[model samples]
Target: MVLRLFVPPGEGQHYIVPKRPDPLGANATLQYVVLSSTALAAGYASFAARHERRIAPPTKVSRTALFIKASGRLGVWAIVVGAAANAYYHRGFTTVVVSQLVQDPTPPKLYEKTDKYTVEDGGLAGAAAGFIAFLPTLLMRRATVPWWTRMVGMTNIGAGTGVIAAHAYFQYTGERQKAMEELERQRSRRMLEFHYIFWDKLLMQRLDPLLQAYVRHNGIFRAYHVPAEVLDAPDKYGILSMPATEPSTTTNAAAPEHAPYYIAAPDWTEHLKALNTDFTQSEIENSEREKEALLKEAEYMAYQLSLKQHAFVHSTHTNDDDRQRCIRELQIMGIAYNRLRASADEADRRIFAGRQWLRQRAAMDANAPKASWLAEHPFIPDPEAHDPSMSIAEIRKCEDQFKIEIQVFESRVRSEVREDVEMRERWRRDLDEARTLLRATDGILWELEKKCPPKRDVGEVEVRASAVEETPKVEEPPKSLNPEKP
Candidate 1:
């Protein structure tokens, strides 16, 4: 037979019965389990992203970083879980426990004076329990991660917590179907924020040391994940497909043979700088070429266009096919010039952006600015700048807001850039077509000059005839003078 131990205020006694479950305590335990599971999931995502084999080899993670990461996860979990557990236990499980007390079969004699709970005793016991509970509160006293990681994590956790709370609320209110539908509909947004922070936590742990090493090895911190090709070809928008380079025999004589890959940092930075320079140089060359192209087009127009030629075409007899062809070439030229102007304007804008980017990188100042933040994060916002006094919870809210903003901005920028590139390409094609048409129009005009000469006025022809007939009346008998021959 199973026996249960019962502790009265005065004595501990043994009784034969099944162990009574404290429903409130059980509910609290369950809530803890849920919290732990969520925390563990986040941890696992962090770990996998940091250590994934396909991406990069394992880099040394600083103990400080790991501790800070774990501590944030643990502390956040504890507070949120504690509050949820308390709410669940007090609101629902406590009533069930009190109702279940009536099912206890012990006699009145079993309930000694110690078994009764009085106000003073309950208060004393509660004070002890509260004192014990206060220990977990100390964990949140100091943050373990860097400010940025804390900013990102807190934001992620808050969003995740809201999602969980919303789910729970839906379940409580018997709107499970609606909740499921919403979850499915907004799955990408939810998943993106969740995973971004999840991976970001891991990256913060890995990147801090890497970035520090970059600074130590090289003079500056080049943000990781700024596509290798972006640095490789800063002048261009996309990466060039290239073969891998062979190892070089050149070496820095002053450097240690076994020095870790700090060279990669400067090499990349220099490449980007070179690309920026190249882009500037290319822009100058392109501007010159654009001027030449426009001049050539203007010359072609000067040679082909004139009131005399236009009047000749309308006055002189011309075939329908030739007339239609001439009109088509004129239409093509007009469209080409209009598009070329647009393309030229767009190219100037792109060139300006390139120059601005170069200037920004060259003159990078304090880390407080948004440019500096984007260099580090590429897309995340500056929480400290937004609200220096924000708590972890508030930082999290800020993070969510920033995340959404960044995504939308990125999408908009990408679409606009794509359209711009396409427009530029289309303008080039149109310019080429116009050039071809101009050549074809020249050939057609040459054929027209041969086939149909311009009409002359009768008065002008008579004057020309009189000037030629200085001898006068040599027409006496062109054929009669040689009548014998006729």
Candidate 2:
């Protein structure tokens, strides 16, 4: 397409000049068409960049958008420079096309002054290439531009462009920072969810298989040769089978919401001898039963809460609010469970200790020197003795208490030992009891065998001793009657 400029009458002898193609081997028309379209596109891209951040600046955003956005800004300046140059080249063209206006009537006697003051109204048509600048260049038209005019124009354009670039740089940096922060947040979220994948995906797909595999390998890691103390010995411990309270664990028929039954069981001590072993043992057993009931309820509560929490955890659930709520609920339930478990463990230890005390008491030898003393007065601590952690003041306090108690106990025991009774009856009773007890002791048999060796039965001994060569029969020296017990 040819660009035609028609000079009006008297401008340069009415004629039309068509712009020629550039000597650079490119069609002027094609260049203009391409530049016009691309320049418009560049403008639109710049406009969109204000909102899109040159295509959103996300890590996933391509760099090509930013490149284009930058190129567009350069294109705008290029267009401005090209338009300004073209307007300068055709500076005087508007003179004949515009309507001329004079300050006053064009008087016959003032014709030269009127012509000198002639103002050319370029209107909107000529202002397009002139940049529509506020400072009019209408009267300043000349074939050669003054150096200062060029400097002023250059300064204004450079300053305006520099201001735009500075603002854009700050905005771009802010947008990129926001993008980086958003990316960082996303990464953190993934990090948090990394472990959850096992529960959500792996477990969901093969939970049964996983559990079965666990069962298969469990025996390999299981303990063997468990000690007798750890095994529940109902008979030895003097505790009957614990009634199945699981069914009734949650039932609080008498108490409202299981408002705890109030009872404090005092510990074993000589001062409480009136209550007796039987009552103390019963209270311990009762406490264990109560703890067991509470443990069962807590376990049930925890299990139920666990199941509920598990339901909300899967990725399939869309409601985040419910899952968050279940998170807190499960924590509270876990706390309750742990509290009950600890209480139950303490109760078990107390009951086990009580049983141990009972067994020791029952097995004690009454003939032992301290047995009678211990029966009435328990906790006979050594006044001077203390744990390594005890302070001097604590030790002194204990010593004072122990001294008074020990004095009382020593005086009572002495008086009891020295008390007179019927002489004949006391002697006979003592003699009979001593004779019976002496007969029951295994040391009597040991002494008898030591004095007179038992006749060896060859057939009886040979049956079990077939594997060993027996020593030749000889008179063996007498051995000690008291051998250490296995």
**What tens digits encode model 1's per-residue C-alpha lDDT throughout 323-400?**
777777767666666666665665555545455545555554332355442324334375333322213233334334
lDDT of each: 0.39, 0.38
Clash totals, every prediction: 2, 0
lDDT of 2 by residue, 1-486 (tens): 111122222221111111111111111222342244344545665665566655555533223343333444444565466656444333332221111211121111101111111011111122232234424543555513333433333333333343344334534555334334433433332232222323344332433554334323432233123234323433233322221111211212344332422112234443233223433454465556657676787789888877876775654645888667777877888888888888788677667656655554554433335443342224537423322222322333443443454454344434534343323343344334333333433344343334332453212321324323353353562232112211
- The prediction achieving the highest TM-score against the true structure is 2
Could you tell me which 10 consecutive residues in candidate 1 have the lowest summed lDDT?
10-19
lDDT of 2 at 396: 34
TM-score, candidate number 1: 0.19
RMSD (Å) of each candidate, 1 decimal:
35.0, 41.9
In the predicted model 1, the residue pairs found to clash are 68-144, 155-396
